[model samples]
Target: MDLPEIQSIDDLALLVEKLKLGLVSAATSDEYEFSDEEYKRIRKILLSNPMFTELIPSYLKLCRNLSGVWQYIKHEFSTYAERRGFHY
Candidate 1:
């Protein structure tokens, strides 16, 4: 399948939704994790598309942005499972 273009913050929001993100609490005795293989597969698919590969840096800054720019991405990530979905 073709990967969706995440060229902007809006696009990233949509991508987060499509991926069905959610959060989990680490305080509990039980913990969930996503395997390296699964992670690699998603990255592979994303990088498979030139658009996603080229825009990766911009996408990353959404988190690295210390000026509270990460809030947007953080909100999107709130819907993802703790340690389950994409990190950035």
Candidate 2:
């Protein structure tokens, strides 16, 4: 599928939705999370693809490494939930 140009937040959100579905489909197909080899291949693809560069800036991008980003996402969602009066 052709990726849409990410010129704004709405475009970016669409890209995110697409990515979410793709990842979910891949995980279901594999019956598990990505293996090391699969992860390496994915990394190679992202690194080589020019399309990803537009969505992420050089300084703010975290896809090169994702553990920190995962943690950050968790924290961000936790903060958001707190603001909305949601709790554990």
- Which prediction has the highest TM-score against the true structure? 2
What is the C-alpha local distance difference test score of candidate 2? 0.43
Report residue 81 deviation for candidate 2 (angstroms): 9.3
Candidate 2 structure quality by residue, lDDT tens digits, 1-88: 2333447767656645444443333323324354434433444444455777675434225534334334444564544434233211
Clashing pairs in 2: none
Each model's backbone clash number: 9, 0
Instruction: Give the top-scoring candidate (lDDT).
Output: 2
- Indicate the TM-score of model 2: 0.36
User: Which residue segments of model 2 deviate by more than 4 Å?
Assistant: 1-32, 56-60, 79-88
